[model samples]
Target: MTPSTENRPQMSVEDFEELERHASETVRLEFINGRVQAKPVTDGNHDQIIAWLQRLCMQHRPELWLYGDRGMKVERYRRGRARPDGVLAPFGFPAGHGDWSEAAGVLMAVEVTSHDSDTHQRDRVEKPDAHAAAGIPVYLLIDRDDRSVVVFNQPEDGRYRHEEKLPFGAPVKLPEPVSITLDTEPLKEFAD
Candidate 1:
């Protein structure tokens, strides 16, 4: 007999932990609002930008920690559990965990868009609401399609009150919770 729909387990932190328990080093997945998602394959452009940001954060803010592909706990029940491309957290705070880190003490989250349209939509549209709801102080999105970086801040009522976009050649200023001017010159756009 087929399992009843109600009996099937919805994606949650428990599932996330189970996946993490058996996942290979290369496996990358995200749990969002009872939906489990496989992260799209990242390209050179993605790696380049992440490396630049990592180095930049290290240089500017030696006291904090910048981690890649770290999972965060957003809500208590539904629509929680996000693993951003990069996360900047306070010193001594646990950045990696078996399940998910509580959103508290998280300074910022970053997403480097993939070429896939669905990935782009999720990064551009869906994640901001989730991150804002988590009360993360800042959210940075690097859009490969547009070769631009968008910063979201001032989370209130599950949405950001401010947004600023800058082209790849321009710098994006990270607002309070952390203070630093990101240099985007090293971030290269995908070749046409």
Candidate 2:
């Protein structure tokens, strides 16, 4: 699920950390710059897609670990902390957040698009900048809104130098990071 920053106030990283320490288990929050955006609940389709990608990545690398919406503190991006929908890290990286992990060991981050406008913008626009700035090698976006998948690779100067967008039925080729191709044929669209 993507986060919505509607009435959220900007909070410093220190303040955000303090808030997270005492945050309720019932409400999930992601701090970007100073905004506290509530993460939406994911549906079955969202869960299925995440699992599918995890399987694909794990199958190829075998040694890499995959995370689901773990709070990550991206040091290179500096000003923001993101809980990407999927985080692929080397074997020995913490499975969950005790403190924000530096984006150094992260091979790739995956974000599955949701229905809200704010969510869409966060996944499609804001996060790419943040992820690239964090020096993450690859960013994979499975966009429900467009019924397509896009891989952003070759991070440089705060952005990915290469982007390949493919419709659901086509294969998405990931470079470096994982260095494998993913089949999107199993993904199903939401019913109207």
Candidate 3:
């Protein structure tokens, strides 16, 4: 995805966390720049996709660690945050914090895009750059709007030069840093 050189929102640690203080159980917030916004609750279609992924990752437990929508705080250089719908990491990293702002051991991040246009854009663009900057090798986007999945790999200088999109029902190959072999067909039950 070619991003315009246009400025994207970048937030400080303090501003990034305003959501936790105000967000209700029904609304989930993710940080953007110095502001936080509510993310969409998945529709029936989207829920099926998430369930499919959850099952796939769990099947290979012990070898690979699977993480679901949770805050990740990467505080090393720039303090920021992200909550991926699914994260695949090698099992050896220290457990506890899934927040990218705290530690940078995340190997892969997968965000299942909802109908919200803004959230979709952030997941595809802003967060990928942050993940790359943190040295995350792979980023996957399960686009609900388009019924497709995109895998970005071959990170160079904090950006992915290689990207591939697999349409719904097609088999998707899980790359390095993740141990499972899967495609979207297994997850169709969650699709709307």
Candidate 4:
């Protein structure tokens, strides 16, 4: 589900930032692949999924924290902005950050598939490429649509060189830098 950026309106980072700032609280905005995208307000099931992952991270890796809806600078040359569902990093990593933070020290960028028209292109394709290009070590996609988890790592040359997908009830290991094994059985309960 790769998105074609050819017809996307070219927007400067500054312009995107200004627009994002003025957007209503309910509307989250992102700049990916040279285009501005409005991120949909998550549903209850989506919130539950994020909460579940946050609890898991807290239990397995006390030193780390899963920051929800944390805006980040991503993609090649940090030209993109994304508000990932969760950004896993060391505790207090975002203490002094402004609206958007650099990708440094981020262990993983996570997205739980939203029930939306653009979920496929936004979560599955553009996000992985943006995070990989930013040199973020891992990109975790919890795909509600397919009831599976996709782990992407070993980023190189603006892409992830390794990818693995597992169904909702299986155990999934989020590789190095974020070495946590998830018992995904609980995820099935949240499947709408």
Residue-pair clashes per candidate: 1, 2, 18, 0
lDDT per residue for candidate 4 within 1-192, as digits (tens), equals 866779564789999999999999999999998899989999999999999999999999999999999999999999999999999999999988989999999999999998899999999999999999999999999999989999999999999999999999999999999999999999998878
The candidate with the higher lDDT, 3 or 4, is 4
Indicate whether candidate 2 or candidate 3 has the larger lDDT: 2
In candidate 3, which residue ranges exceed 4 Å CA deviation? 1-11, 74-76, 90-103
How far residue 142's Cα lies from its native spot in candidate 3, in Å, is: 0.9
**What's the lDDT for all of these models?**
0.79, 0.79, 0.67, 0.95
lDDT of 2 by residue, 1-192 (tens): 656775344767888878877878766677764577776767788888888888887898889977888777753447678888999988778746476777878899889887775776688887887889889999998888778888998889888888999988897788885888887777654310
Worst 10 residues of 2 by lDDT: 183-192
TM-scores vs. true structure, each candidate: 0.84, 0.87, 0.78, 0.95
Candidate 1 displacement at residue 6 in angstroms? 14
Q: Using TM-score, give the best candidate's number.
A: 4
Global CA lDDT computed for model 3: 0.67
Ranked by TM-score, the better of candidates 1 and 4 is: 4
Candidate 4 contains a number of clashing pairs equal to 0
